[model samples]
Target: MTKDFTPPVRLDIDHLQSLYRSGGLTPRQLLDRLDDYQAAFTDRNLWIHYLTPDEREPFLQTLEGESPDSLPLYGVPFAIKDNIHLRGIPTTVANRHVRIVPDASAFVVEQLLAAGAIPVGKTNLDQFATGLNGTRSDFGPCGNAFDPDWISGGSSAGSAVAVALGMVSFALGTDTAGSGRVPAALNHIVGLKPTLGRLSVEGVVPACQTLDCVSIFARTAAQADRVLTLADRRNPTDAWQEHQQPPKRLMGQSFRFGVPAADQLGLVEYPEAQALFDATVAHLEALGGTAVDIDLTPFSEAAALLYDGPWVSERQLAINDLVNTPDQVHPVVRDVLSAGDQFTAGDAFSARYRLAALKRRTDAVLATLDTILTPTCPAPYTIADMMADPVALNARLGAFTNFMNLLDYSAVSVPAGFLDNGMPWGVTLFGPAWSDSTLNGLAGRLHHRVTDTVGATSDPLPDEQPPQPLRTLQVAVCGAHLAGYPLNHQLTDRGAVLVKRTRTAPRYRFYALAGGPPYRPGLIRTEDRGAAIEVEVWRMPEDRFGSFVAGIPHPLGIGQLELEDGTWCTGFICEPCGMDGATDISDTGGWRRYMASMATTETRQ
Candidate 1:
């Protein structure tokens, strides 16, 4: 079978779709190829339960008479973490003693299955999703895809490895404290931990019920984004589910991003990892981002509260019966959850109070930046090393990730580079809640820039990209609405950000309209004689745009105006009748220059 089978080089959503269209591969062929590939990794501890051919047959048969173009994820294969429900499949969560066969799939899983995705199997994880290092599992440690000796970084260990090894196009993993991201860094894949509640956790075993998030593991950020779009559905039945509003696209051609202060960097002991992080910062700068040093004190303090404070009790509450019978749990995970016994109800309230204060501080810092960039994990550790110092080392892996859920942020971890020893490494870009798409877009661009391949595969990165977000619109302002002018606040107060200062196409006439103290300029497209007029382009959330346009007075209205670069955007334009009493100011070049001339005239008088 191995000699006759040749696996597809890439399993990205687009690649799979193209193959299905061209008749190069079918869902059954890919599944058979994956089954053949899995034979070589029997000892890797990547799966807790490998689905039998009978178990996968129904999903394959569902798409038999359907066209590939009918469903968004038609024929895509995905792995489900052992903790999440998959209909009749057993959810062990890496602990055989508490295994339960759920009658229905998770809310997210059902959404994927309905869209024609095949559930390959349930992958291994840290028992009860309690640890950061992958070794704290009853099924044995899941090692890195590149080297079986190293830790895969978990509790999402097997999910990351499956995607990294290209056994599936994507996988579902749950993240409460770095489980999703740490594994991605170690295995070289894209791990997207969307905002809490963005993906419903209706059928998943919870680590900390309030903090648990169903995350996606894929070969590229684009694939992760595609999976997220399909999996994220409004689950009115789940109390914890939230309807996320349309996200604003904050990351653009130029953005400000926060980085941990030099003294607070956790990679001080890992020189190679530190060097890679520095290079990543430089690469972001080259991509039009300004690095701003931010104090990591509040974020670090909040991270400590997750395990050290009463939040651990939430994990205990999630599995009440198992907590009472600690012997059933892995020894390391048992020790960790046992800490919850010491906290009282008072401790929970006090911890919540402290978290609220720290949240304020973090929010203030983020308000000035588009996103925060951090190393996904401090460094890679071997499975032997992880098992030896389980507690301390697992805490180290959560250094940059634990605070995200507590603070309600969206994050995407993408492969950054590899270390000297050939271990993979990655960095995360995170921002306020509902910023999932923006972070994914930025991560995708950065991933392509730093690496040519995805996971451990030799397949080249796909040229086709994820659809760009359209939640914001760009508008150009030539007069009163220009930055520092009287009407500029109208734009700024509506959450608009200045994109750039440029000139319009040399096919417009600029006129100073007859108006009061806060005068306006009128731009008219002229074919015969015209000159470029200076303007400032600003982008604002689409939801706020209607209000911004509604407040415009008389002849000045929003219309498409061509810029010097030939790009058209909504901008201020004038009706021909409004030019009756207006003075031509074309010779002054722009509104700013004309205003300067007026100021000089007033001083001389």
Candidate 2:
């Protein structure tokens, strides 16, 4: 070996990507260094199965022709929670009694691999993903990355540790409630939970199918953002998959953020977490977020529904035959799932109804704010403390998290500050559905403001880079290309942003295009028969405009259209021949409104 061939110890996506491009590192070299890193942290209990050279060769083979610039995750190594399948790997869900070797990767894992990411192993979890504390596993606990005596928050424990320990650039964990966030908080890493169904959960062993979200843990928010981008690609096979596009509402220069009213924060017993949260509020304000105190009663009630209410029955549905033999499960985990058998179908409906009411109330309150900030975990506990009273410790860890999936929101947990004892503390930025990117940007800007270290490592924080706006043309859109709509991601993924919203001039006709999966609309200029319609103007990169135009298929074409204010620009236009037998939708005035009416009409039919 060359004497000065230093390894790329900073395993961030951007850093490693740069090293790869500069010829400073190679995939083989990275694997060798990871071996040294794992050897140093010998007792962390972070893996259910770390891949051997033979096991990883197939993955490396897939990356032969990939380029990092094209596939941003090319050559990057990642780990998955045991509950999620990776083809040819055994998914045990942290239990030896239950082993399932899958022939297919989960939808998200397949997407990651296709984008050039390599899987190194599967990480340990709470048995069946049932506990927030890591100790319920037969493989033993995954201790805190900072302090071995402290608990490594679970049920995604080892996934977080693998990232914090620099074993991988990122790791995947399933978050039903707080499993994703708590572990990141304890490990001083970024935990990102997208909106429900945002990432396809197909092939993931669900704890609660309706609430499960495939989450990501990374050394920085930027890295997590990249993984989220890749994992959130459109999935056609997963029934739960939703086309969750980014929100368009801009926070502007000054944004409104909420916090639990003085007495509403549930951290009275954990003074350190409480202090850190208070400081976090101030930090948000410094970042141009106006902090407001709001009542957390409705949110707290919704959180209780996850475990205290009949939603426990969903756990019973997840593990088919495993529940038949409760002895095979951990005692506390079995105790929790046993309650599922006691709930009647009527109980499930009642709990759901109550949750709906709370969601309505939460929405009404949150309409006045951009996001709500809170401690990622209200209290940090030792492994002994969690084991002494399993159920209660888990609840405390989930205090600020369980309500998120229930309420259909998105969140990012980032390192806030360290506790006096040198353990890391963190806070979560949360908002309504489709706001994953918003919370991501805010969490990162806040992390840069508050911390200077990554995980338990002595390495310094990477240099912060300001976001650079793309050079784009201000193209007007009136249909599917609008933000949060079905096809909006095409614009967003290409660096487009919705800049202006307005109505078109009364010289165009709207028609519902024939044929569907992704239904679309077409507009045409007519001499006399026309109506002014709603439209959204987006700024798209000139370089991307050609590719965007190329994907317009046949019926729709790019052409000039007049806006309400007497301006003309290229927009959606339909070929007259393709309009045969198409339904006229000018009455609805816009594509979104037209689609809403079609849905309502279908429901009635």
Candidate 3:
């Protein structure tokens, strides 16, 4: 058990695609890696449920009849968190008393099935998805994928292990309070938590409906992104699913990323983790991104609301049956659920009001950066450590994650590096909702820039990306220039693709600059009186973005643009002093949208 457990077998999405196309490995050959994984871990509680190869034979047989192009995830295996339902498999949530479901796959699982991914089995989790540590389960805790003695973080514990051990290509876990993310940090993988409601919640047991997101666990950022974009499908039967507009891509050669102050609790712990994170910041700077220290008071306040405020009521509501009938649940889960009874509806509204105030404060602080970068987890933990004091350990695990869902932000946690103990440490790139794709692209680039290692596989890193015949650049445009709006053809004529339609980082103000052919927005950057103005990032060849920027008139110029995430790119930014006698339109956060809203309001009046 003491022997190091890095799986010799590894699988990555892009590489697997290349392999499938080139015939380096067949679907069946890859599935055999499961046997290797089982042997490597040897009953590591990584699975609360497992599908026998014989049981998966029919799926494998069907794959052989289809062409490689017919199946993107053809023969690729994945694991599911026990909280998510899978047909013919039990959804236990690691609680022995729960009855196995007779039918239906979670919407996310159904989509993966359609993509031709085979499910290995349901993995373990904290009972009812209540804790960050895997140890809370009735089933034994899933050990860290790298070191058996340490904890494999939860509630996505076994899902992370399944991927880390190469048991599957990727795994699905639910992130309520960092369950999806912390495990990835503890067990070297990418954990993608899409904006809330982007992924459907149907067929999954709820932890906290308003805050829960089905997350992906993969070896590389690209794989995680692929799964995320592919899995973000709507289920007609599911009413809770929220369709998001496409993510706005941010364009720039260099970016300015934001980091928590050096004195921050999470940032200061584990000198080595801090060093690794700081080194990553330095790497980004060297690669043309700037990092700035910011006060984390607002973010911390939002995080406190998750456990300290009435939000605990949401968790209580999620398992009302178990709470009312405590005998039906695991002891630890029962205790966790019991706390929810402490709140009333009045407390919920009061918390909401406080959260709104915090959001306003956060928006003000967010106005200064492109994206925010933080350690995925404050520090690592082990099974024994959690058993000693589960609640406190769980709280520490969510030090970074609890606030994200509550604030309605999108984030991606990529493998930054290994800790001094040889366990993994990860960092997350976070931005406001719908900025998922921007963070994904940035994360993909950063993953390649740093580790260059794909998944848990043994394949060598590919050589540098050769220059594209026409390298793309992301450009931010507001006002009559926005897509589908008047004068929008300026970009289409130059072969630009609209990647997303979202707001700027919460840092810029929109102004009705005195005059133009069609009124234009003059984006002025300021210490206050500004919000992240809405804009779209169009991917054009470097030459095209350049030509477009050059044609932009004075007062309306493209400088550096920050997305909701803390990463900066070249976009639209006015001279800080541009507000002279100009009508302040900062409250709107976007020029075109603001003008349209103003026109609508005028009509209504």
Off by over 4 Å in 2: 1-8, 464-605
- For each candidate in turn, the TM-score is 0.87, 0.77, 0.76
Candidate topping TM-score: 1
Kindly state the number of residue pairs that clash in model 2: 0
Residue-pair clashes per candidate, as listed? Answer: 0, 0, 15
Listing every candidate in turn, what is its Cα RMSD in Å to the true structure after a full C-alpha superposition? 4.3, 11.9, 12.6
Local accuracy of candidate 2 as per-residue lDDT tens digits, 1-605: 00111224778778888988888887778887887767666567888888889899988887776667888788898999999998888888888888788989999999999888889889989988888878889888888777778888999999998887767889999999889999999888999998888899998998888889899998788778778878877778789998755463334345899888757776765677677888888888888889888898999999999998887888877766554576778888888877888789899899989998999999988888888888887777888988899998788888889999999988889998877777778889888887776677777788888877677765567864422122236677777787778888887777566656788999988888888857888888887889998888876556777888888888888888899899997788889987887888898889888878879999999
lDDT of 3: 0.76
lDDT of 3 by residue, 1-605 (tens): 34334454446555666777887877777777666557656546887877778867766787777755887787678889999988877777788777567487888888888887878888888888988878877778888877767888888999998887667778999997888888988876778888888899999898888888899998666667677766878778877788665443343455668888767855545788888888778777876688888888899889999988887778877676444466867777777667778888899999999999999887666666657888888777767887888888788888888898888888888778877766678888887676666676677677776675543444444433322111356677777778778768888767566666777777676788776557776776666755877787666656566677777766666778777767666676666456666787877767765777978999999
lDDT comparing candidate 1 with the true structure: 0.87
**What is the C-alpha lDDT profile of model 1 across 232-251, one tens digit per residue?**
78899998988777664466
What does the lDDT read for residue 409 in candidate 3?
80
